[model samples]
Target chain A: MTAAEERAVIDRVRRGETEAFEALVLDNQKKVYNLALKMTGNENDALDISQEVFIKAYTGLHNFRAESRFSVWLYRMTYNICVDFIRKKQRTPVSSLTYTDDDGEYMDLEIPDTRYEPAVEAEKRELREALSRGIDELPQHHREIIVMREMTGMSYEEIATTLGISEGTVKSRLSRARQNLVSLLNSYGTFSKSGRHKTGKEVEGHG
Target chain B: MADCKKYMDMISCYADGELPEQEQKLLLAHLDGCASCRALLSAYRSIAEAAEETLVQVPDGFAAGVMEKIRKLPRRRSGGWKAVRPVIISFAAAAACLALVFTVSPQRFDFGRNKAKMSARVEAPDMADTAERGTDSVLMDSAVPEAGSGEFGGTEAAKSDEESLFLYEAAGASADVETPQTGMATATDSPAPNGAATDGQPVDSTSQVTRHPGVKLGIAGVDENTLVIYYAVFTFEGALPDHVTGVEKTDRGGGLYSLVVTADVARELINEGYTNYVIGNEDAETALVYYTED
Candidate 1:
């Protein structure tokens, strides 16, 4: 949604119109959910966090200063909520803290059968799983900044505002996150010149 | 002198197409003379492109979940400006009583341990210690008949005194002034449903009691019109509280808590424009009522 449209919706929402909020939710939910999923490396937690963030935005709307755009404010709240959850999890030291599928797994998208063979489906799933692991393995700070930059397409200034850090910090963090991601994706398999991962260059045979 | 760090950092910026012409020329000149810097720039450009490609496309139905959570929140009860008529009267009555209490005998209730315990309650990792707060302070003052009495050492009074001290610590938090930066409010000194005020004096309106004993308060009253308040209460693994049902949390970092409240509340807030706030009082200790209009 355009910034003006968002502002109008937010204005309507503040006036007690329930439907107006759906625009705000519909507009940014995907980005918010994707960021959570990437950061927590789990789907269920991401969904939960995304929902919680909107609820928080609704209640804290009173504190929403006009210095920043509504989207930036919302994103800032999202980052804070995610970090708070992680902090809570850390406070309780437990043995064998395996990343549960519910912890960071994305909701399994229902892929309609295009008459693809079972083996093709399996390969696709495996690729997704590999990508998920690679993203999950990044350091917490790096993973978060990368998600903000790449998934949300937020500028460095916006990211810094959301994360309560300097623009320089945002740039540094994004650079590091990208470098880490490159190394991770490369290790999973070689990337051909076309950017797709090549399981085996010879067998794929593009000469 | 060491070479300019800004000039060096410009290589990464230039690859991003973010460098000014002068800086870009300086970087290219440096790269021409320095193979290491050239390689570094190339590596950064590649990484930037890869990062751009690495973003995972967000899946569908994410908004539905966020909206769902916002729907579950409790609505705010706006009493309008005329509503303050009774509240102001009550505040006046309470102030008069306070003056009478002070004039009769100016007894300083030194909430020594009470203050410490209150701080701990507010900052404790969990809200478990909150219950022990009010019950302990009042018991301590009355039980200790004398400051250094040995007769009550092993008696029930001693036990009650210990409990009261615990409550006192939680109640006597540092006084908060009515400042713009932090508009803090506390509960008025009315009796709880089942217990008396632990401290002999009225529990000052400086420490607000949280609703749902173990719940920690988060942002309250989205705006003047929205009725629902949000709390970072309890552990909801992979989900928010049933009321805050719809949101999906993202990683924005820092010790921040965020949630989406329902559209109705959002609209109400927008219209009201944040003109009023109703902090927790004795009967309703946890909730704060804020309004935009009269």
Candidate 2:
């Protein structure tokens, strides 16, 4: 929906029209859930966080202020809720940890469809798993910035505003995060040196 | 050629298309002559591509699940007596007592010392230890009425104390304060500096005294409207709390510390064994609790 339509929906939700919130939930849930998935690396935890974010947004609808885009505000809430969830998970003992049933619901979009040949599918799965592992290894702040920039595609301005940091800090931090990811992928032997060279040539030719 | 190291750092920004026109042009020119830089740029691009291509799909009915949960949440009531219940109760109780006293003895209502004693009788339990600690003396210095300023009946003294108490209650009710700036008091032994008051009011040390079981404590001079209280428990001496919830701390120069927490978190921290002192009324803009342990 356009920004104006989203604002109208929000206005209705704030005016005691509870069902109007569903439009917002539908519009933003994918990005919000994906962000949680990327940040937490656990599908159940992502779902839990995503649900919690929408619930919080519904309750906090009156505080929306409409100063920034609704999506930016919602993303900020998602980021903070994920951070808190991570902190809570760290505090909880492993014995008390519980996992939700897989239920075949959460899917990794990067996984190739059945149409792909088995060998290509396996390689794609390996590459995707390696990238996930690489992302998981990053420190929380770096992971957050990477997800915000890379996964969510937020501009530096939106990220800086969400994180309450300078755009300069965002740039430097994002650079550091990417470098760390590259080093990790390299260490895992996911990308060969020659492969990188070939990729460079292809990109340069395109440029 | 542009220095490889300098341009290498800019490659990520260039890859993201964040660099200014001149810097992008410079980096592009450098890349043409530099093989290693080109490889680095390519690696950065690859990483970016990999990151972008990485997408996680939500479970089916994800939005529906969220909507279901939201529907289960109890609906919040619109403003009414329910919204202002606490304020009404406090004001009604205070007024009722005043009315009872006036009906019993009209002459007694005009006595400043009697009024002071009555207010003290109502306020003393909360401030008793603070008075004994001499913090009240420091606080009174800032707020005590001049000799001829109608000490008990003076609007200034009454208003300031009432406002101070009101700010405190308001803070306790709402735990929403801006992040407080750390002040420069580092030594545990040194007195809090002059500007440490959260609201820029002279810290009324007497107004915020809390008597814990064995310790007589004061929040020194925090303004509730601008600061929230954080409950910090250091496992060892000088260690920070392991899990801080909504609140964040500001180092007030010495061993003294100030915390800012949301009103909800502040309420949770209260009675959780942290030294609790409040400053601000119901109308106060922020809820701030200044906590420290002896």
Candidate 3:
């Protein structure tokens, strides 16, 4: 629904036409579910997050600012809930910065050969699966930025606002996330011409 | 090649069409010479394409279920928690003596599994105070609109004074929490050791766990995973702020548990970016505080 439509239904619900809230739920559930699903990587947890988000938005409707788009506000809520759930589930630090540990070994960024890249659109299904697995392998912060931008199509500004970070941080983190995914898929070597036992660059040649 | 790092960062923005006009020109010019960055951009686009197709079907009747729960919400008059909290605090202070009586007996109450059924009283003097608090709580409860016809206000209408006082905040967590009154604790698996239930142990057993529904609903808007924090001193930094009125060190070597405070204190912890602490075991008037050092 448009922000206006959302506002209208919200007014109706506030006016005691409680059923009108369902329209808001239906309008936002799919993307919200997709965002949640990608973040948690669990169907049940995703559903739990999505359902809870709407229930919260309805109950806390009064706190929503008039100038804000409900979708942005909704996605922000989704990100926060998933982050808390993630923090609770895995009691590890969800940091995005590059750091060296006590052992003096680099722990954050690892460089993979960009030359051995998968050919895009050559084998869509297999490439898709490779990407999915690659996403799962990413660090928690990387997974969040990737899902927010590439998967859920949130703009950098939106992601920055949603995550309470600067837009520059959003861009940098997203860059790292994509690089890590490419590195992962490169190791998979699904359509990499240089990969052993693969000669052709597949049908979709590199530009 | 050294400049490629800067251009590489721009490629992500470029793919999303978020790159500025000048930076876009610079990136495009750089891309002509940098095959690696070009490959990276292609990979980013391909990832987006695949993600666009990757979706989990919304479980059937999702909307209907949400509405079914929403329709059951209690009607609100001129207020919500904001309207009711102050009254509860003033009265809960009058009942403040119960805070001692409440904390002293831990196993007597089970905050989870709906196992809190402590009927035994301290004595007649405290009983008079307890009875007074109970009446004040009922008066506090009257500020909220009466619950809708359903499973609520059923067997709960006759719960003992302690149960009623403690359960009031759970009931206040959200509207949905009020209805499924019977099985609110249906999801909890680990019972958090009722033996030393009153001792605040800072444990982080993050294995897949569930909590009573009201606690979940209560922190849904702010922070959902808060109640999992086991203690204060281990996870919270610095000395307890002066606002932390009572700081009785436990026998567990400087460990502290069971903070009773007002609402703004809870908001302060949340706003200060302290993820480890959260409010719990609250009535309309007072709250149980858990702040973490980590």
Candidate 4:
């Protein structure tokens, strides 16, 4: 539906119509689910977070102002809920004392290349998996910007507004997040250890 | 290679298609000679592409599950001002409140970590609505004597307390007020609530609010017409009982809180020896719920 039609449906739902909300749930569920998955790195957690995002959106619809798109609003809720979950998860018994300290500096640790294989397909798999793992392991600030910008496709302006930071900060932080992810991927041997040999040509075929 | 370090942030913005034309050109020039940066940009693209393809199949009947949960939620229904005219409230403890406000007197307001300043606020969109709809509120009818006319029954103690007091648009809205003294009646506008309309004076919303909880927060009312009053500056002598929602450090900092209360919450606090510590009137403005464990 067009944005206008979506807003009209929201108004209808606000006035007590059930069907309008049901349709909204179906329309936006996939993006919401995927955004959650990117941030949490687990499908089960993503599904749970998706349901909560919609529930919060429905109950707090009155507080929503119309200046931004509903999707941005939905994504803001998704990011905040995901951050809460990550923080809670970090606080819980992490199951391994040797992993990292309170700062969760496991991202800075080096991992052996036990998972790496020489095959091209295996290399690609290793890269994607390492990327996901690296994203999960980054500091909270880095992970947040990467998830918002790279995973959710938010513009710098949208991100700055949602996060209440300057566009300059967004640019610098996103740069720093990418830099950290690259280093994390390198540590996991996702890059060829011998001179870091993967070239621009290899990645060009991805698009 | 170190020069490439400076382009790192620009590289990120470029990857997101956010770099300005001039900077993009500069970065392009740099990337031509730097094979590593090219690979990095390509890797960035690959990551973006992979993320786009990372869709998990949503479980069946997800929307149905959401709808079912939504159906169970209790919907809140409130009418606009025109329909709901019973939005005014009167404090039954106005006279008793006036008498005891002076008892606590004033201590140096260090606003210490161990001290929890309690306050409450009454919310109305505007006084114009209250003036138009408060007819059903007989308590409101008796309160609000003529504004700016010398009808105040305040004492020397009340006027002296007004120096630290500032008028607030709403009762208890200010958390940092060391003295909770305020009023709206009589010769001064210090009595916060009951004095808004004594001789049917139309409360001009444009009037500066200088409400203090110390003078007389009598008949504090709101559009709910739920009454709102705020008084904070509590000093608790002991640990809060379990029934008391334990010493939570609010987001602002430790040992400071402002709660908007209803008659029910006030009554609950009253049952817990709250009267000995502070004024525990049901529907109180919470003139001063300053709690601190010694």
Candidate 5:
């Protein structure tokens, strides 16, 4: 949502127009849901966490300090809820924890855009599956930081403020998180020789 | 160098555009020339894109689910004493119930837990007051107490009050730095008994260890395994400015000492070239007193 539009919604919500919150829910639902899906690596858990996030947002709206943008705050809430879920799951590991990446191995990007081609779609599906597995394997802190940084495009200071941390810590954690993800992906053998291993190296280098 | 740690540290900030623009440009230029770096950057972008793809999709009826919960929450009556009455009544009832519980089953309340709780309650008020001062020093004298012993159990409330006294005294150190008339606990050369005064207190427990030769400052409410500290105070050549606070006094004890500063000031000091102190005893300081990054 545009800044102006978000502000308008916030103004309405602040004035007891609780219905206006639906506008927010509808607009950011996709991104929020996507974040959940990535973090949980399961559609059902993702959906559950996304709904839980919105619910949490609604109840905790009173605590929202208007110093930063609402979406930034909302994303932080979403990230935290997901983390809690992951932590709880870690304590009581479930059968789903060991689920294999069913999607095929190859990321065949060389194929041209052929209409109605099953092969290309299959490759895409496999790539997505591999990506999900790689992400799921990342340490919780690093994964969430990456999701917030890359997916939401929040600045370091903004993320820091949202997470109640120093920007230096955020930067440091983010660097570590990315480096960890690169190693995880490399270990999984998901990347082809074509600039695949180097990507992680470069990220590690820069981080 | 094949293993350049500094360059590795820049990637995360670089990805977030946190580096200076010129530094970012330089990094990008280096990436353009460095095949290994280019591949890694591309891989990072891909991974980020993949992460973006993985966001949780909220199910339908999410708003309804939330609205339902909101509806169940007890609403405050509109305006004035009518609205405030329920809160007061609930609080009174809660207090009565707690009193009855303790009276009926006095043994139910573990003395140590009760003491800790009491101290916690007392310290909260002092924390609020210190927080208002902005530069107030926070002194937390946390004791795990030996296993199967309750020496401090009955004195929890009084000791908590003492903790507040120490906090108020520590805040005084800040008073000279910023505001004046913080509290009256004059500075002294000898370290007080740990049980007597927070600053000059005498050490009663042989096990009570001194960390870094002074008190430390840090935030509470972090997991033990993942203790993350954002602040630490070390030596200074001259006396602390009248407006500055140190957690401990320097040799000669000339200036008002404040062991800890707010996280904001701590960050600034770090950026301006402060050092992280490495202490010997981990068990000596409470989790709140020591800071670390997990």
Candidate 6:
């Protein structure tokens, strides 16, 4: 939806037209979810944060001020929530020990890849996994900036606004973040033969 | 024969189209002569391209799940107090405990002060010289050329709009000049132009510098990241100065405006006058105009 349409829906929701919020949620959920996923590096946390963002936006609708784009405001909330979540997680270390099921059998926790499909080609999966690992290795702040700029396509200005920083800071941080990611990817040997072959195949497939 | 290190620092800006025309041409020329820089640029480009091409799909029912939670939220007027109460209580309790402890053992407070004094005593000699040099640099950096005073000696007050724009743009470009990552902590620690006294200890020299009249946003104690975030919020809120020049919108629809103010306006805001006015609050009609240390 256009900004005007989004504003209208927000106005409706403010006026107790509760269903109107669904429009805003539907329009933004994918981007919000992706942002959370990128930051948290897990589907479950991403989903949780995405839901929390919409809920917080709904409840805190009055403070939004409409000074910035809705997406920028929403992303700011998402960024803060994710940062807090990460910090909280850091403070409390989780046990790696598996939980026993009702059958009294220990079950290995599996990382569910909801996006996985049998038809997905090998090269694409390898590249995605490599990129994901590279991204996961970054400091939380750097990762957030990269996801905001590169994945979400936020301009340096929007990012500065959302993250509450100057454009210069945004540029410097993003440049450093990218450099770090490149280094991480290099360490993974992704710049080598198999990776290069996959990349060529991936390019050819796109072409 | 431009320095490779300098050009390397600028490659990202060049790639982002953030470099001015002259700098862009200069970087392009350097790229032709330097093979290593070319490879670095290629690496950066590949990373950027891969990032752009890779798409992360949202899970099914993501919106529905969000909507379901939204429906469950109590349609209350304001939940701000409820959300903040726990934090407020925790802080209050901590403060009360500290007060109780201080009341019982007043000598403890003196011990703390003594400890601070001892540390300050150790650092005093070194800090004094650093402060003096810092002030000199601040003056040198902010000295604008006087109008009709040839090319080299007046404050920004003497410069015309075009001159102001040119100087400000040049400053902005150089402001992004990369330093070693380890340099950032020390860089931020350099004395603020206002020479804000730390721990209530007065720095007499701070008073010698002329204070420009007008609204001054004190940035002495705030951390760099917080300052940047506040500036962004101010931009979104549209709280910046009125006369801004050289407005350029980024590819993602945020504005970069050069905040040009005469010397007489205010000394603090003019410290790093230019702003990247990313987004403005539609209702508030204000832009973020917080200054960063040049």
TM-scores for every candidate against the unseen true structure:
0.48, 0.55, 0.55, 0.53, 0.50, 0.49
Q: In model 6, which regions exceed 4 Å deviation?
A: A91-125, A192-207, B52-55, B76-294
RMSD of 3: 14.4
Q: How accurate locally is residue B273 in candidate 1, as Cα lDDT from 0 to 100?
A: 23
Report the Cα lDDT for candidate 4.
0.49
Q: Considering the two chains of model 6, state its CAPRI-style docking category.
A: incorrect
> Of models 4 and 5, which has the larger DockQ?
5
Q: What are the per-residue Cα lDDT tens digits for candidate 6 across B1-294? A: 225545643777776667778888988998898655665566666556667556577777777777676565433344221221000011111122222223333342333323443233223233233323322221112233232322221234532332332232232123332211111121344432234233332222111111210000111111212211111112212334233321211111123222212222221221122111111111111122333222
Highest-scoring model, TM-score: 3
DockQ of 1: 0.11
TM-score of decoy 3: 0.55
The candidates' DockQ values read: 0.11, 0.17, 0.23, 0.18, 0.21, 0.13
Q: How well is candidate 5 docked (DockQ)?
A: 0.21
Please identify which of the two predictions, 5 or 6, would achieve the higher TM-score against the true structure. Answer: 5
Sum up the clashes in candidate 5.
Answer: 37
Taking the tens digit of each residue's C-alpha lDDT, what string does model 6 give over A81-183?
6765675476221222122211121111121122322234664456567777777666666677878876777777778756656787777666656555555
Off by over 4 Å in 5: A33-52, A82-125, A162-165, A194-207, B1-6, B77-294
DockQ, prediction 3 = 0.23
Give me the runs in candidate 2 sitting further than 4 Å from their true place: A91-127, A194-207, B76-256, B259-294
lDDT of 1 by residue, A126-198 (tens): 4455455655676676667766765577777777655546666655555444444444544565222222211
Give lDDT tens digits, candidate 4, residues B1-294.
546666767877888888999999999999899766676676676667666544455789989988887675433344111111111122222322222222232132222321232111122122333333332222223233222221222222222332222221122233443321121222242333432333423222111122333222332211111222333122223333333442213211243232233233333333211222222222233333333343
lDDT of 3: 0.50
**What tens digits encode model 5's per-residue C-alpha lDDT throughout B109-202?**
3334234533343233333222222211111221111221222222234333323323222321332221111111223443322323333222
Which digits, one per residue and each the tens of the lDDT, describe model 1 over residues B202-250? 2322222331210112112211111122221112123321223223232
Docking class of 5: incorrect
Which candidate number has the best DockQ? Answer: 3
Candidate order by lDDT, highest to lowest?
Answer: 3, 4, 2, 6, 5, 1
Poorest stretch of ten by lDDT in candidate 1 chain A: A198-207
TM-score-superior candidate, 1 or 3: 3
Best by lDDT: 3
